[model samples]
Structure formats: C-alpha cells, structure tokens
Target chain A: MASLLKKLGSFAAGATLLFAASAALAKPLTVGFAQTGAESAWRTANTNSMKSEAEKRGINLKFADGQGKQENQIRAVRTFVTQGVDAIVLAPIVETGWEPVLREAKRAKIPVVIMDRKVQTSDESLYACFIGSDFYKEGAMAAEWIAKNAGSRSKIVELQGTPGSAAANERRKAFADELAKNPALKIIDSQSGDFRRSGGKEVMEAFLKKHGKDIEIVYAHNDDMALGAIQAIEEAGLKPGKDILIVSIDAIKEGVQAVVDGKINAVVECNPLFGPKIYDTIAKIKAGEPVERSSYNVDIVIDSTNAAALIGQRQY
Target chain B: MSKSKSLSPVWWPLIGLAVLVAVNLALNPAFLNVTVLDGRLYGLPIDILNQGARGLVLALGMTLVIATGGVDLSVGSVMAAAGALAAVLLAEGHGLAVALTAGLGVGLLAGAANGLLVARFGIQPIVATLILMVVGRGAAQLMTNGEVVVIKNDAFAFVGNGTVFGFPFAPLLAIALFVAAQLFLRRTASGLFIEAVGDNETAARFAGLGAARVKGLVYVICGLCAGLAGLMAAANIRAADSYRMGENMELDAIFAVVVGGTALTGGRFLLLGSFIGALLLQTLTTTMYNLGVPPAVAPVPKAVLILVVCLLQSEHARRWAVSLVKGGKK
Candidate 1:
C-alpha cells in the first residue's frame, strides 16, 4: 500500500509538471473558417467581422473564400481537415450537398460551427451548433407585417432570393405558411430576384407589367429585392410605400434607409453580426463545455417608425 | 457567274430578335416603353442598360478576336484582375487618373501575356486564354486576400453610376467604344487585314499581311474592353467583390457575339449586331423576370427563347416550318 501511494504521488507530481509545461507553451487556438464568397455586402461584413474577432482573440484563423461554388467550398473544408484544425466554421453556400463532407469532419473529431447559414442534414451529430438568424422566422415576420399593414385581401408580389439556398427555401416556406392563415392574402405573382438589386428591379418591372393594379403589396425575401421592387413600382407610376406596401428580410443599412425614406414599409433583420456569438461558442467548445446543438431566434423586424433610429446603429 | 449560295448570317439573328420582341409585346405591352425614360432613369430599364453595357463592351473586342479566328476566354478573368487592381489603388488613396492608368496598364499586360502565348508558342487561343481564365481569378482573389475593397471616391463613382446628359456613363462608354470600333473597322486597312487573316491566315500571310501582329493586337483590344467594363462595374457598385467580378461574363459575351450573327467559326464581324444582341439579351432577361417567373425558373425561359431563336434562324428549321405551312395550305 505504501509503495502504491509513493507511485501515485510520483505520478501526480509528473502530471502536475506536464500540465504546467503545457500551460506555459499553450498556443493560440487554430480555427479553419471556410466562408461563402462575398456575394453581398452582408457576406463581406460577416467575413470582416470573423477575421477581426479572430485577430482580437489571438486565434489563428485559416480562411478560405469559396466564391459561391460548392466544389471550391468542399475543397476548402477538406483542406481544413487535412490541416487538422481544432474546429471548423462553414458558411455553407447551399444546404443539401454537405452530409458526406460533414461526416468526414465528424470522423476526424473536429467540431464544426455553422455560421449565418444552415445545412439540411438528417444527422444532428455532424455539427456542434448553428449560429444564424432564424430564416423562417424572418420570412414570417415579413409576411406578418404585410398582412397587418396591407390588409388580408391585398394582392402581393414576392421576390425570392437564390433558389435552393437554405435561407431562400426556409423563407419561402415560412411565408407560404403565414399566407395560408389568411385566405384573402393572395400572392398574385411571384418571381426569383436571385438576391440581387438589378434582378429584383427587372422582375418587379415584369410583375408590374403583368399584374398591373393587382399587386397591392411586395413581399421580398430580402431588402435588396424590396429596394429594386420600389424602383419598379416608382417607374410604373405608383407610390411604393403608399400604393404597394413593401416588406422584406435583411434590415441592412440601405434597407433601413429605404424604410425610413418610405420606400419600403418594413424590413425583417437577419443579423449579419454573428462574430461575438461564434467566438464564444468556439471558446466554450475548446474548454470542453456543453454547447447547444442549435442556436435559434436571432432576428428583428424594423419598420418606418424605428428604421430611422436603427439605421445609424446598423452594421450591415 | 452564279452567286455563292452562302447564308446571310445577319438575316437570322435579326429575325430572332424581332420574334422575341413580338412575343414579349404580345405577352405584356408595357415591355415596349420609353415613357419613363429620363424621369426614372434608375429604374428597371436602366438596370437592363447597365447589364447590357458590360456584355456590349466585351462583345466589341470579342468581335475582333473572333474575326481573327480566335477566342479569348480569359476576358472575364482579365476584368476581375483589373477590378482588383483598381480597387487596391483607389483604396490606397491614389489619384483617379493614376488608378485608371494603372488599371488599364494591368489589363494591357494581361492581354499581352495572352497574345505572347498564342503568337509565339502557336498555342490554341482557347487553351492559352483558358489557363488565365482559371488562374487569373485566383490572382485577383489573392490581390485582395479574398476580401472586398469598397471605394468612396465621387470622381471614380461618376465613371460607373454618374449620369451624362441624363444617360448613364456606362452605356455611353459602350456606345462610344462601339462607334470608335465601327469607324476603325470600316475605314481602316487594319480591319481589312483582320478579315483577311480570319478568312485565310495562310493567304493573308502570303499576301504580306502581318497576321501575328493583328492577332496579338486584337487580344490586347479585347483585354482593354474587359478591363474598362470591370472598372465601370466596380465603380458603379462603389465596391470590388473579386469573387463576383465578371463571373460568367465570358459566356454572356460569347452568347452576344453568337446572337449578333458573328459566326463562331470566324471570318466576319458585326458591331451593330453585337450591341443589339446584348440589348436584346438584357431585355429578354428583364422581361422574363417582370412576367412573374421565379428567379430559379427564369433561366428556363431564357434557354427556351434562345433555342427558339436558334431554330428560327436555322435554314433547315425555317425550311421545315415553311413546308409544314405549305402542306397545311394545300
């Protein structure tokens, strides 16, 4: 028993010395972030925020811009895997084609934190936590604002974002769900604006030509489209906020400005500032603390009344 | 002597444009409009002009390249590189003239690289430009470290978004380039040499024309056009997102050239036809979006329209349609 105690004491001292040495030589956490390309101002800001936050935290961030291509993103993720990063952050371009790659990350025991966008995988174990605005809630907020302001009987035109995108899919589904509650609230015309200002304007112009007086409201998936729709409405000799009420997601500064200027009636904010929250999660995971598998409910609705005040504080 | 039974290429694309316009007008009469013109100059019609301007500029240079029996797939990458360079320079507080000059110079250098590879090494133009197409974007991305460089200079902004006598500067630039190219090609011996080289490089060389020099210069001109278009696009948005800079632009330029009645196999060039083709393409996209088609589904109608136009332009398809009409009448 005495000999066992002596061995135990020596082992304890050895472990203590090893721990002290490790603490002394502790390197900054290395993170691999595979970002979707700067397709929008929000995306650009997201990337900048990540880099700045990483710098502030003294974490080594190995970054890759996927340029909105799936193949490039896959390659980036595999590269991160090969680099043996402690954790991986992916702002996925699309949702469906991620299972195989994510499985690979899981096999490697690398914790993945999904940022800004969500993946549609059946296995929840593949990712640690998804940090993003609830896209469905955002879409529903836009729909609810439209219903309240434009009346249930108002005819609406929807300008969707890119097809097959998780945000676009969820936003569309949620808006459709909300619209189902009010039978008189009909979508007379709907088109994909491809999440671009020019695309939105072009489509809105077509909607104006085809639907004419039928379109009483424009429910855009994002503010850029709403802004474009406003231009189309104005060009068609109709007042945008007055004649055709507009509600959209993504309360970007320009979108807020549009609301304040009375061009768009309301905007549902999909907060692009996920840096602080993401860094906190990463730190928590590194410390072997419990982290939620899903982070939900990060969205706000800004309207004409509050738009002016919030525009100054808006980051993206 | 019997006239050569060659097809008049211009006849087909014009007919196709006419049919598309007719269909669009029939579907929605508001499509045919100049009413809002100057009043809502930043409206949907203006957006169409913006999208077409880049394609128009690229097509102009592509016309010369195609006339020399060569293709430059690197035009899009060249645009990205130029935009990246301009953004970096402007971000560093360089003067507008210096930034513009440097941007053009970079474009010229990239073009020269393509010209050298093709002229000196006798590499296939497609293969030569393809290498740059893949790597040039990477170089541009590297220049910005894959970050967007937003600019706030009013003078530079005017080049893209500013209005000149109530017209957007981009379209104006495109028109100016078109006019210059028209004058150069119609009234110059260089134009004849280009045609000669495209028609038969051996014959042109035998006739004492400097075929290599003409070919090299055409690519340089193509590069300049792409570079200018890139600068305009970056300035218009007041930001340079390298990833999206000139993405898939080469396809649009090629489509414009093909739809403009420029033969893909080379020989002849058409400045007016290419401009019109660009305009028509933009108009079609704008019209389709306006017609309540979902964004995901917008490409479908565009593809269908292109197919219809292609079929209508084909002598075989036209002959088939005529025979069916005749049989029905009998």
Candidate 2:
C-alpha cells in the first residue's frame, strides 16, 4: 500500500511538471531583429517601427545593430541561431554575401524575413519572405503623375541618386521608361546628384544657368535633392512650385512638409514603416501557411491635398 | 621663354580651366552668359565659384600643409564635425556668434591635437591626421545622432548664400581670406620659416627657425580654414549632414593643392595656383552637368581631363612630347 501511494505521488508530480512546461511553451514568441544600423532618418524610423510593433504585440525581442557592417550582421545572425529564436528578421546592407549566413538560418529553421533592402540568393528558401518598397514603382508613379498633370511639352530635368545604387538604377530606368510612353514629356537633361543636398544644389544651379526657364519640371529621385533644387530655384529668382513643377520620391517628413508648403508639387511615398506588415507576414508563416517569396509594400503619392494631414503622421 | 617662365607654376591649371570653359561654351553658347536677378549674380561662372568655395578654402590650408611635407587627411571630417557643432548649437537656440565661434574652436582644437600628435609625439603626419579623419566623422555623427540638423537662421545662412556686390559671399570670403593669407605669408618671415622647415627640418632647427613650432602652426591654420569651409557648406544647404558633409573633400583639397603646382615633397607652395585648381575642378564638374553627360560615363572623361592636365604640368612629360614631335616631324 505504501509503495502504491508513493507511485501515485510521483505520477501526480510528473503530470503537474508537464502541464507547467506546456504553459511556458505557450507564453510568448521571441524574435531576433538584426538591423542595418541607424544610418539615416529613414532607417531610424524603420527601427522604431519594428521595436514599437514588437512591444505592442508582446513579443520578446532580441535587437542587434549591425553598425553598417556585413560581418557584424552575420555574427548577430549566428547569435540568434544559437539562442534558438522563433523568428529572425534581417535588414541586409548589401545584396550579395548573405547566402552562407542565411543557409545557417535555414538549417536552424528560424524563418528569416528580409526588410528594406534585398538579398541576392539562388535558393529563395533561405529567407521566408522579403518585404520592401518598390523603387521602380515609386519612380513610375512619379512619372505617371507628371504625365497626367504637366503639359505634354514639359521639359524635365532629372536629379538622380548616387550612381549605380539599386535605388538610383531602378528609379532612373522606370522613370525613363514611363516617360517614354509620353514622348512629348521629354527629359531635357539628367544628372547624378549623388543623392546629396549639396550635389543637388550645385547641379541645379548649373542646370538653371544652362537651361534657364526652358526646364518646366524637376524630377528628383529623392526629396532631399528636390529641396536643394527648390533652394537653387529660389536663389535664381523663380518661384519653385509656380515656375517649375517638382516631383520626387521618398516622402520623408521634410519632403512632405515641402509639399505642404507648396514648394514641391508632389512626392511619392516610400514608406519606411514595415513593422505591422512584417508581423502579419510572420503570423501567417507561424500558422504553417503559404507566403509569397517577395512582397512589395504599396506606396502612396503625397501632394498638397494629403501632405498637410500626413505630415503629422511622418515619424522619420 | 619668358612667357613660359612667368606662367610655369599655374599655367597648366589655367589652360585646363580655359579649355573646359571653351568646351562648355561650345556645348551651349549661353554657358558664359551672366545675368543679375534680385541684386545677385546668376551664371555658371558664378556657380562654379560658389560651389568651389569649400574646396578653395580647403586647398588654401592644404597648400600650406603640403608645403610643410605633410597632409591633413582630417580636413573633410573636421568640416563635418565643425558644421555639426554649429548646426546643433543653432538648432538649440544658441546665438549665431556663439555657434560660429564654437565651430571654429572645434577646428582649432582638432588641429592642435593633430599638431601635438605629429610635432610633440613625433608621429607621422599622415597617421596622426588619419586618427582625426576616422574619429571626427564619428564624433560629428554622434553629436547629430546621425541625422541632419536643419538650421533656420538667415544671418548664418548669409555666409553661404548671401551676395556682396552681386558675388556669392562664400567665394568672396574665400577670395578675401586668400588675399590676406597671400599678403601675410609673402610679406612676412613666416613664409620663410615654413619653407625652411619643410626643406630641411634639421637644418632649420639648427639654424634656430623653430621647426616644430612652424609645423604645428600650419596645421592650426589649416584647421581654421577647414572649420570655416565646414560652416559655409552647412549654411549653403541650411542643414548639417554629418554623414555626407565634406565627404571626400580632403581628396579634392589635396588634388587642388597638387594641381595648383605644389609639390607633395615639401618646400615650394603656390596659393593662387590652388585657387585656380579648385576653380578648374569645379568647372569640369559644371561642364559635365552642362553637357548632361550620363553619370556613369562622366567620371571617365573627368579622369582623362585631369590626367591630361597633370601630364602637361610635368616638365619632363612636356619636354618628351616636344622631342617626340620633333623626331616625328624629321
């Protein structure tokens, strides 16, 4: 009877321990986020979005800042793998050189989700999904807006971003392609502003001197360059929004503000807030559901009509 | 021969500038056209001067530094740091005077640190300045939290955008500083001391020329010039971008100094040559823009043009070319 009573006690204790272990397992999901450093205002906003979203969802997050280095990001990934994170989110700084580390994550079955920039790999299985803004579409949207709004014979001067960068290449190609549909809207001159305000100002000053009032439209890859061009235009004794219709991408706070001020005609939004969408995608992946290999966040066009109301919503 | 001798030091850069200007004019007949609007000069020529102002100031300091057989790789970074400090100060509601002084002070302090490292500790100038080059940008980024600090003060902006007698203030300030420095250096024993130390530090020291002190002093002056350039760049944009402010400007400054006929090996220096060199480079950039050269292909032509000018600047290359032409004619 005594031996039987002892066995019953042991079974009860073992059953309680199993129940506690199951409860712990169902507590909350833990995720590891590998960010590509706070390099710019856009990047800072992206990071904040992710962090705040994680907090709102009650996920245990392990954050790692790569500090603009690929090696550091790789190390962070390895650490996440070792920690046995439920999911891993990576914002790669470059496209290539991510396959090996990603292969390791795949082996761990951590479900890596790429954000903002892209990763070039033959095996798409290495990453669960990629969520980023479509640079080409953004450029096309800007061009489409111009074709509809500006006169058919409008002469456009394009201020490109840094040479050979992904954003610059795609934006330039798409804008040119879209503008090709409307041959009358000719790009009179295009130059690389190196995606810098100073570059934009200098190039705009030259363009103003060379082309003068002949340029009716200034299409810049990014808003910083647009702002710089606005300064150049103002300095040249011409009203920016009145004399030249300006269209640009990346509706950063300053860019949106410029639209609100009526200095810039329109700005295409390249939304940096990826937190909510990323979490939704992760949830689908967690539920053992099929997910798209690559998904683009739909961008919006912000003009004077919506700019003022949207300005307060801009976090970056 | 007399004409060639008179133009020997700065003639090549001048020719390059003239050629580029001629090319721009060829591309567009209106390239040289200047008009006044709102009491300010508006033209490609004025644009070149205004845009080249930062590089001109940097070259001014770099010329002196190179004359002493040293190069300050930190000028660009110092520009970023000083501009960041000034922008941050103004953003926080500080007076323009305080902001300007603080910005200039950062340059002086950074220069003094570099001087101490090189002169006092006997570190190589390149390595010593390299330390600041690496740290200065980081410091600037830290101060601005890696975000651009937008400045909204018109008084400060005037330094970069405002014109005096229809000329951009930045270029005018640069020219005025160049003139004053030229007079001061050429009219005093200070220039002799710098040359002596640069030529032979041991000989200058043995002759009681205070070689170390001269070496230290040049860095300070360079720092001050870079600081002012930083302020001008920030004011022009009305924002301090710690990341891109003065990026690669040290290289431009060095190129300007070298193109201006200053030997990297030390001793001989040309202040006016650097000024023209800076203008020539700016003209090349403007020419590219005026011609609308595709961004990817622009660098190739720019490189070729710089190579030709550099080759022409070489006495040996010119003599060899002349001899080759003579032989071919025969």
Candidate 3:
C-alpha cells in the first residue's frame, strides 16, 4: 500500500508538470471558419483553400457551410462561440443584419476575420481584419485594361452579374467611374447575365442579333459570363478573343484556359483562394503583432502576355 | 384520334404563339429573319426554339405524369443530377456512351423512386416528388462537389449545339420525343389505361387495369425525359452546372404543360399542345429581351400571360366570350 501511494504521488507530480508544460506553451490556434456557402465555383474554391490551408498550418478549423443564407451563418457563429474557438472566420453571404450575431462573438472575446464580402457595421472592432480582393479595384483594373487596349472610343456592352450582388454593383460602379475618364467611350448596351455562363450566352446572343458589329467590347462581370459570351461570338461567325475584346474578372480555371486559347482578352483576378494568405494573417494576429484592418489580396490584370504562364497556377 | 380533334388542343397555344410573334414582328421586323450559315440555321426564331427546347423536353414527360393524376415536382432536380453525372463521367475520361447511359440511368432511377413513393407507398404525388425536388439537387451538388464541371467532347457537344438539316437539333429532338410519346399513347392501350386511371383510380382498378403500374411507368418516363433535357442543356453550354442548369426549370415545364391546356386534374394528355406552349413561353421571353425589359420584371408579364391563358382555357370564360360575340352579331 505504501509503495502504491509513492507511485501515485510521483504520477500526480508528473501530471502537474505535464499540465504546466502545456499551459506554458499556448494551445494550437483553433479557428472556426463559417463559410457563406458553396453556391458557385468561386465559393467552392474558397472553401477548399480554407480547409487545405488550415490543415497545412495545423490549425483546427470548424467548418460550417451556410448554404447561401444569412440565418444559417448566424447559427453557425453562435455554435462557434459556444465551442470557445480561438477565432472566427466568416465569408458573409450578404452585407447587412450581422450586428447581433457579431456582438455575441465579440462578447465571447473571439476575434472575427471577415473574408470575401463585407459586413455593413461601422464598428471597426467587429472583425479582426477584412481579407479579400478589393471589388472597386478589381473593377477599375479591368476597365483600365480595356480602355487602354481597345482605345477610348470603343463600343462596349456590359454583361453585369446578379443584380444587387456586391461584386456586380461595385464592379459596375468602378467601370462607370473609369469610363468617365475616357469621354469617347460609349456603353452601347448593358444587361444582367446573373453571372452564369448560360446567362452570358443568352444575353450576348440577343445583343449580337440586336446590335451586330456595333458592339466592340464585351465587359462581363465574371469569367463564366465571358466564357459564355465567347460561345455566342463564335456562333455569330466572329473571333471572340480578338474580334470582340473580352474583359472579365475572376481568373477561374476555364477563364484562364480561354485566355490561353485566345477567347478572352483579359481577366482581373479576384483570388478566391484565401488559405495561405488567411493563415499568415492569423499567425501574425496570434503572435501579438498588429495586422491591417483591411488586407486586400493582390489583384493581377491577366492578358495574353501572362495568361499562358499563369494558367497552370490558377486556383479558381 | 380524329384529324379535327388532333389539332384542337394545339390551336389555342398556336394562336397565342402566332399573336406574340406577330406583335414582335410589328415591333421589330428583324424577328422574322432566318438565314442558313455554314449549314446551320441562325435567327431569333431559331434561338427561341433552342431556348424553349429544354422546357419542351421536360413538358413532354410532364404531360404524361399530369395525365395520370400526378405531377412530378422533381423534374428540375433530376435534370441537375443527370447533367452532373454526365459531366463527371466525361471528365473522368469515360466514353460519351457511358456518360449518357449513366446520366440517363440516374434520371430513370430518380423518377422510379418518385413513382414507388406515390404508387406503392400511397403517398401524394406532389409530396412524394417534392422529396426528390429538394434532395436530388443536393445529390447533384455532391456529384460535382459543388463546382461547375466543364468538359469537351465532340459527339456530346453535337447533341446540344449541333444541327439536323440546318435546324437546331435540340428543338428537333424535343419534337421527335413529343411525336414518339404521342404515337406510343395513341397506338397502344397505354393511353386508355392512363386516362382511365387518372379519371378514376379505384374504378380503373376495378375494371382490371393496373393503375399503380401505369402511374409508376409514367413517372419513370417523366424522369427519363427530364434526363434527356438535362443532357441537352449541359451540352448546349458545354458545361454542367449542377446549381443553375435546371434551376426553376420544373416551373417552366409545368407552365408549358398547363398553358398547353392539360388540366391539372388529369384525364387526357396533349403532346403537341405542350410543344407549342413551350414555344409560346420562349417566344414571349425573347420578345421581352429584345424589347430590353429588365429581366427582374420579365417574369411579371409571363405571370400575367399564364393567368390569361388559364382564364381563357376555362369553360365558363370560353362560353361567356362566345355568347357575348354571338349576342353582338344578333
């Protein structure tokens, strides 16, 4: 009995030491990534990048797909707070109605990192930082490239993305802003393609039949729409990549492939793959270093000059 | 069927389509222009035909299901599943035949499942089909892992974007399917059994007809038709987007079926009516687009149009209109 007691004492001391040792070194960061939803190819890439990036950095990621609903995102945030995660990452589906849920996370002292879309709240403390491509910049980048390449007086028809979507609205705004600088540039027609390949194709076909060769440039909000417009252009017996100067955003795989194939003239990168960049920010924040309030991922203006080389590295 | 009655159901939709076309012609004379370029027909009319082909194909199968006192709400989801399956199969280096078979097979099985639920399990057709309408889209998303699966195959591409004798093959295929469906019903006892079962199930069963088997068979055919439509849509765009490919297509198919004068209560079916109805809907949409109406409000006019068509199809409304016209003449 005495020997057993001695052994128990030593084991208790060892247990204490082990606990002390672990307490001395902070526990690995556990980030709860509350993804908006995998509604599109971009969303899929965003989710995939977060997951794989989390695995690479040894961070425990609690993922919840909100299925394109704000209510689902709010519920997932509540669950993450209850789980006592180190931090929370949110790719908001919409721009409003997040104050209450965000307050709950803030009350728990969990720093939130917003990605993809913005939260409408004015409070800067609601999130640790915003990490994504600047929509306004993405728009300007495409417009500048188009205006420079196609000359100022080119006839442009815009295939806008889904109406009321941030990407669509902001991109359209930036394009308008840039077009003002070039007085000769005229937008002959504009319509919403809903950011789908099929929509782009249908709308472009209508534009072709209506306007014919009057349309010199097709400004699609995203690559899918641009790709769809290419089909329409080809069916109309016109070369897409050259005959119609195609400028779109989001360097997705097929879009880049099209650029290489000489279908799309230029694509502005939105960089949906946020894994490595996100992890780097989290590491800095954890190390007691100040991070930027809004970190914009670098946007690239991809055209024939660099499209062929970058097609292999394209993530979304 | 008698020659006069054969085209009876077709005339209303045909007239409606012609009227819309005529209005478009007056507004924009370019709407009637058709030209053959490089062995393919190209024009606004042909574009409308291609656009309507997806819904027309679904309407073809939906007509049969509605004929048997059942509605398959799962047609749209089935289209997504078939498109995703075919896309994934082709992406995995499988032959076009394998992909087509597998895609159609998924559709048939999905339809069969709906049939079983309603026929064998005694569930309401709407509720039974609703289960698939919700779940099958998820199944499609899973098949593609929530990404648009883009593929390239010459033969498969030909099915969607190809032409037969210089007309778009998709519209032709829908017409062929409608004709085949019409012949199958008119030439065989299946049509009588279906009409009998739909009109009164217990009475038909008492009359020694297999009502459950008939309902199950129609649902299966409905699934197969949706599968073909899904394939055509995916092929048309050369990409299978499970999320958006067949999104809300069920409503379009149902609209075509209803506008074609197929009563929701079920008894008789009309194949050509659905075809013309599909064409009518497509023509209206093209007109709206050509007129530069915002797409958000595009559905508003369609809603009004369908309401008018429904009201016009009612016996009381038809009798009232006829009486008023005759009284004026007197």
- What CA root-mean-square deviation does each model show from the true structure? 6.3, 4.4, 3.5
**Candidate No. with top lDDT:** 2
Better of 1 and 3 by TM-score: 3
Instruction: Give the alpha carbon lDDT tens digit for every residue of B18-68 in model 1.
Output: 777687678767666544444435444666786678888888988888888
For residues A15-87, what per-residue lDDT tens digits would candidate 1 score against the true structure? Answer: 9998898678886788999998865677877888899899998889999999889889989998898889999
Q: Which of the two candidates, 2 or 3, achieves a greater DockQ against the reference?
A: 2
Q: Give per-residue CA lDDT, model 3, range B263-314, as digits (tens).
A: 8899987888888888888888778767777655777887877777776666
Q: Output the lDDT of residue A59, model 1.
A: 86
lDDT of 3 at A165: 80
Instruction: Tell me how candidate 3 scores on lDDT.
Output: 0.87
For each candidate, give the TM-score of chain B.
0.91, 0.98, 0.94
lDDT of 3 at B206: 96
Considering chain A alone, report the TM-score of candidate 3 relative to the true chain A.
0.91
User: What is the C-alpha DockQ of each candidate?
Assistant: 0.29, 0.71, 0.50
TM-score of candidate 1 chain A against the true chain A: 0.83
lDDT of 2 at A280: 88
- The local distance difference test score of model 2 is 0.91
Clashing pairs in 1: A192-B294, A192-B295, A206-B290, A207-B290
